[model samples]
Target: MMKGLYCLQNAIKWYEDRFCVRFTPTVIYALYPKEEEYGWPQPWPNPDSAGIYIFLDSNKTIVYIGKASQMGARLDHYFGYGENGKCILKDKRVDDISYVQCYSCSQEEPYACLSLEEYLISEMNPKYNKTGRTEW
Candidate 1:
């Protein structure tokens, strides 16, 4: 939703203003669960870019923040079920995630991925992230 993207935009601005560096994400996609599937979105728009992703609850509250070098594969590892129909076990919070916001930057922006992820986790205080959360 826009609220989630708003937080991301704010995070980008905050990081740039504080560090005096540019952090621009090239592709952003908001994915909702499929009615008949139990895996990451099919035909993911970006499979190789390094970036950060946010998990949001049904109410559009951000619950988790994560980063990966391969955004599509990382998401598949979480949402994809095995041939035996078993999900790769992860934080139980995954079940609470109803939507995912993926922000992918160019391969040249790996540092941007890491720093932005940290900054967003700190500012948003997503419940599923264990570190960098600011107490409020």
Candidate 2:
């Protein structure tokens, strides 16, 4: 029994890595949109900016998080075509979307939005964020 259990654990880990399960926290936030009334020019006062996004399941669980230089454009991808020309909306698992806009302090900074996004993901430990081992 011990040997079988060990094998199973290893198999699961292998599958996870193979599927790129160890995703950065920002990836989770990039999949969803923030509540309305946040207003246009998102993360306002800083137009033409970058930020992180999140995708939620029907139960309001965070399934994915991601960072993007152009939050609006990245969001379009989630609502429309996926990498393989597949429609994400057709996927029954995705129920809602939201985002938090994080503007960059300077033009040279990279992944600035991602930093805050990662912190939030680690703290929240949302249900759909399978990449992190923490329990919410």
Candidate 3:
């Protein structure tokens, strides 16, 4: 778990080194139910906001990375949904959830968000991202 979390921390560090912009995650958590004892992101901001999610597995290894138009709703679909849910998290049970609530000053932020997805896919090289999964 520490190793995987370190990788994410390293990813942030690398991003900072290259862009000189320190990244701040809006939420960092283990994948527990919203009503669980551990809890979800407290003081959860903007339930309908655009964001990216970094999903970790039981071993705390990063397994999948994806984006959501609405963070709260989408996460609910996966983590807080049914026993046989059809969402991405159906097959793989995530153990941890880290998020970056995204925004942009430029008009092309959506495109940039896509690029961030690509960049993270490349950098993180998660196992479950079968489509266009890139490696270091």
> Which one is best on lDDT?
1
Residue 130, model 3: lDDT of: 50
**Under the 3 Å rule for N, CA and C atoms, how many clashes does model 1 have?**
0
* Per-residue alpha-carbon lDDT of candidate 3 for residues 1-136, written as tens digits (9 for 90 to 100): 1236667667656754775443346544544434342334343334566656666655557767777666677666664444453223343444344332322212324344465666676776777665474221
Tens digits of per-residue lDDT, candidate 1, 1-136, equal 2246577678778777887666445433334444664334345556677778777776768878888889878977767555555433354435767666677776665787777788787777777775654232
- The TM-score of candidate 1 is 0.69
Q: Clash number for every model?
A: 0, 22, 0
Q: Name the runs in model 2 displaced over 4 angstroms.
A: 1-47, 56-63, 80-91, 98-106, 132-136
Name model 1 segments beyond 4 Å from true.
Answer: 1-4, 17-41, 81-93, 132-136
What C-alpha lDDT, on a 0 to 100 scale, does residue 99 get in candidate 2? 34
**Candidate 2 residue-wise lDDT, 4-108, digit = tens:** 223323533453355433322222233333564332232322334465555455433444556678655665554555575533554456455443323333345
Better of 1 and 2 by TM-score: 1
Q: Rank the candidates by TM-score, best first.
A: 1, 3, 2
